[model samples]
Target: MVNNTDLTICLFPKALSIPSGFVTLGICIGNVFVIVSVYSIRSLRKPCYIILASMALVDVLTGIFGFVAGLLFALHGRFFYFGDTVGWLLHKVMVSTIALSLLHHLLLAGDRYFAIMYPYMYIIKVHNRSVMLTLIATWTIVILGLIVILSPYYSKDVQNVLEYTFMILVSTQMYAFHLRIYCKAKKTAGQVSSSTCQAVQNNRSDFKAARITSIILGAFSICILPSLIHSIVIETQGECGRCRLPFYVCSMLAYANSMLNPIVYGISNKTFSDSYKKIFQKIFQKIIRLC
Candidate 1:
């Protein structure tokens, strides 16, 4: 295990500035695209898009506060030095944003599952009011998670255990449920084609939605799961020196999740993708006409 002093000296600001800055920029841009695209396009407003928009909003904050703050810290070689209170606040904000994002992802999965598995009930029962309630619940859970993480009552190991266990269980169960829904939808689609072309089209659309949801979930896991495991191991071992580099890399990867989400979730949907293309084409057309 390298000492903190050695870690700081080796990862000097001059050596770290360029790469971290580039990464922060990329993440911010991707998150911004999702935010802007969703807001500008009216057709994209639906329960599913509401969940995705919530996720993108958090991702934007993550890019701005989490990655951008980290970039500044790296550039100045502050290396986790923001004064005690400020550092604590930033820590809470960063962790809470991440937790909120995970909650949004789960809500998105639930949205897709219900929409597919129970379309009629979903249409009647799930609406803007329900979306608002879901958002409130998401924030409430994030707040509680932050409180537990910040509280001194629980040992760090205990906190890590709780967080990891909750995340793993929720994520695994959500994915499994989504997989079941997708399979059932697929089977139904295969059996119902003879009934009507409309039924087949509806089934196809459901399959597409499920496929996109699964892709987003897969991307999220790829980006965040490593950091989660690393955090658990570090907290359990109570030694961060050897884990510092890996943890930092994992953190960057986790931040990258925010960047990938908009592209994966937003652009994958036909409505959002079409809207994005139209907006860009209009801009280019105006430029050509001016020329």
Candidate 2:
């Protein structure tokens, strides 16, 4: 329902166009590597990695859509060409992708939580099939939720309330799950001395995975909180002329999360780091042969 005139009135500075383009490109390329690594590396085909790959896939879409939207914004200072409906849908899809990315973080945290807190059951239940089913369900729910929110039945206020509620619930659950995981890992470490060597090794592996996931979760929280707060303020107070710039900055920060995630995974997981190296080596060799 946003018109071009209103959009142009609050257009982001043209100087931001290049930097935003680069960031969006990085987001797409980085997440593509994540998805490829997860699929190609047999070792990374576990539940946690599957969820991570799914998240990366969503991020790729976000970056692509965001690039188009940003390009339009920067070029014309508004989505003048797309008309209201298409432009509105593009923005909504981008928002939905971000929501999907956050849900995947929760899914990743849950995977780690169960792996650490209930290893036996986790081994039995959290396989490829179950993970796939869970992802399908998540996609369906989010898509349906987006449809309901976008329907004319709900006012803008209602949509904002629903979004705010969803964000809080997901953030709370993810934090709670990680907190329980940390407590469980600490307690198990104290008891490790009496355990068998194999058990200890397994415990260490689980703890390591949990730690890496925690880092990703922390990064997501930091990146998203600014945008979430800015959004709430804008919704409640109505738009301020000065607030527009800050909102754009906050949105860019949120977009930065997609770029940061792949780096975190590579740095935190030796397996992913090695896979990246191997992929680069292959590409290098191919270029050399071509030359």
Candidate 3:
């Protein structure tokens, strides 16, 4: 007779295990490069960069948490390993960091919208004192949300409510940011240079901002849906459906959101792409010279 744990372990190895393992491991590795790229470059230090840095920090933690637990599950088959009180605390920080990243990225969309469309107004409004105040308020709001999400009895049922609410609000907010940008483009007499005109007329700059914001928003919802459903069902005595397919798909998509930041910058920002390439070449050449 097969034991429950042994049976659980056996089930995954027989199924679509290869792809599941690949995305998890690859994302974890890629996020390290993304983290290094953001912090090493000085020009990336705009306030929106504050949001990006936060995203990178959180994603790195998420990758760590996910891979550690995920790889263990893959190898052991059916084991769900979490430590005691200490593990619990670490988990909270990890969850908070991830949640905070999501919230801050939403703020980043708003930040970029203001910076791009109303550059002068933004500087005046967010001058030294105001910038600090806004950041402080944002920090407080995110911390409070994280606390509520990760507090006691973290079974999947509570997770569903949280996920649903988070998604609905995020989706709504993205549209709001989208609407705001469209309104600005209509109202303003933007620059007419070949480059800056391309940026403003085609709305390239704002669109680039929106691209990151939209992807972060859209991918987050798409990636986490299965996890949300899985958590709730598994926790509450709901459908114990063996839909490894959905979980695996969702997990991979979620992992991509972490590394996708760098890929977006590479495509959208010429300066960032050039700067990063130069920095990496320098580092590589120095290593070769040393050798």
Off by over 4 Å in 2: 1-9, 79-83, 191-196, 241-243
Ranking of all predicted structures according to TM-score, beginning with the best and ending with the worst:
2, 1, 3
Model 1: per-residue lDDT, tens digit, 36-85?
Answer: 77778786666777677778778778877866466547555564444334
lDDT of 3 by residue, 1-291 (tens): 211221122133334446545655655654555556656777555566556655666676766766665555565553233323333444456556556665666677787677667776776775435544666776688778667755554554566577667755865685687578757645653442345544355455555555566566555666655665665565475334443555545545665666666566666667667766776788899999999
Best by lDDT: 2
Please give, for residues 39-156, the per-residue lDDT of candidate 2 as tens digits: 9989999888899999988989888887888866756676323445667667667768878987998898899988888889998888999999999999998898778756766566
Candidate 2 residue pairs in clash (backbone atoms < 3 Å): none
Residue 175: error of model 3 in Å? 2.5
TM-score of each: 0.81, 0.91, 0.68
Task: Give candidate 3 regions above 4 Å deviation.
Answer: 1-42, 79-98, 116-118, 127-159, 186-237, 286-291
Q: Pairs clashing in candidate 1?
A: none
Segments of candidate 1 deviating more than 4 angstroms = 1-16, 71-76, 144-155, 189-200, 241-243, 278-291
Report lDDT (Cα) of residue 202, candidate 1. 66
> How many steric clashes between backbone atoms does each model show?
0, 0, 2
lDDT of 3: 0.58
Cα-based lDDT at residue 229, candidate 2? 88
lDDT of each: 0.70, 0.82, 0.58
Displacement of residue 78 (Cα, Å) in model 3 is 3.2
Q: What shift in Å separates residue 4 of candidate 2 from its native position after superposition?
A: 9.0
